[model samples]
Target: MTTADALYTVNVTINGQPHEVKVPARRTLVDLLRYDLDMTGTKETCSVGVCGACTVLIDGEIAASCITLAVQADGANITTIEGVANGEALHPLQQSFIDHGGFQCGICTSGQIVAAKSLLDSNPSPTEDEVKEWMMGNLCRCTGYYQIMESILKASK
Candidate 1:
């Protein structure tokens, strides 16, 4: 693809699996993850990046995949919601969410989980206020965020 065509082949490591796919230079990382690769774990609500529904970890750092371009993620290690849990045993955060009634509609659960993973990775034990502030990016319209915050804090403990 020519430079003017805005197309490029990007190699990304997703969930420890290497994937090489041709994507438009302008294609968002979320689109590539969801559409091209059939990884629907990444949710997309607000396309502009204000909402954290499209959150994912790039090299263990939280990023909004919706606004991030696929090309930008080239050669990066990405972890989506799919990567958080194993086959049957849920991640500590997931288990906490279930135990604390963190999710209601579940649309925002993916982002919440991914964000909580980022938090837990950095600080295993986070206070309730810290959990609320850290998870501010993820918005849950149905749960009112009470249960979600409780879940993250509980997981930290």
Candidate 2:
């Protein structure tokens, strides 16, 4: 089939909701989430996946949605920032971020929280160094690393 006609059927569970969408073969998971599903919490920055701005939990592991194909995420459980909070109440990480000034410009906050949530899920009560190490891939151009670290640390408690 031609590239223009190449389409993929993806069945994914996002934020505890099931979604089935037909997307182009070239569609990225970020696009599918943002465009098709109207879930905009996952941001795309540096599109190469190095910046980690598009990080999301796929089956409880951090995955770069910008670099991941929507088709590749089939049958996966995806969690974005929208899914992190419990209704009107914020997730501990989100509250900690707000309380600790973990975000400045806010462009990277979603990915940062998502990544931090993954870390905490796997390794609750991680050391400060572990938080730093795990969060290194998520870059904040606003240079709010210390506060971000503090937020994660506080949330772990």
Expressed as tens digits, the lDDT of each residue in 1-157 for candidate 1 is 3676766999999999999999888899999999999999888998988878889999999999999999999999999999998977799999999899999888888998999999989989888778878888788888568788788887885
Q: What's every prediction's RMSD, in angstroms?
A: 1.4, 1.2
**TM-score for predicted model 1 compared with the true structure:** 0.94
Model 1 C-alpha lDDT versus the unseen true structure: 0.89
- For all candidates, the clash counts are 0, 0
Q: Among these predicted structures, which one has the highest lDDT?
A: 2
lDDT of candidate 2 over 1-157, digit per residue (tens): 5677677889999999999999998899999999998888899999999999999999989999999999889999999999999999999999999999999999999999999999999899999889889999999999988899889999996
**TM-score, one value per model:** 0.94, 0.96
lDDT values, one for every candidate: 0.89, 0.93
Give candidate 2 misplaced runs (Cα > 4 Å).
1-4
> In model 2, which residue pairs have backbone atoms overlapping below 3 Å?
none
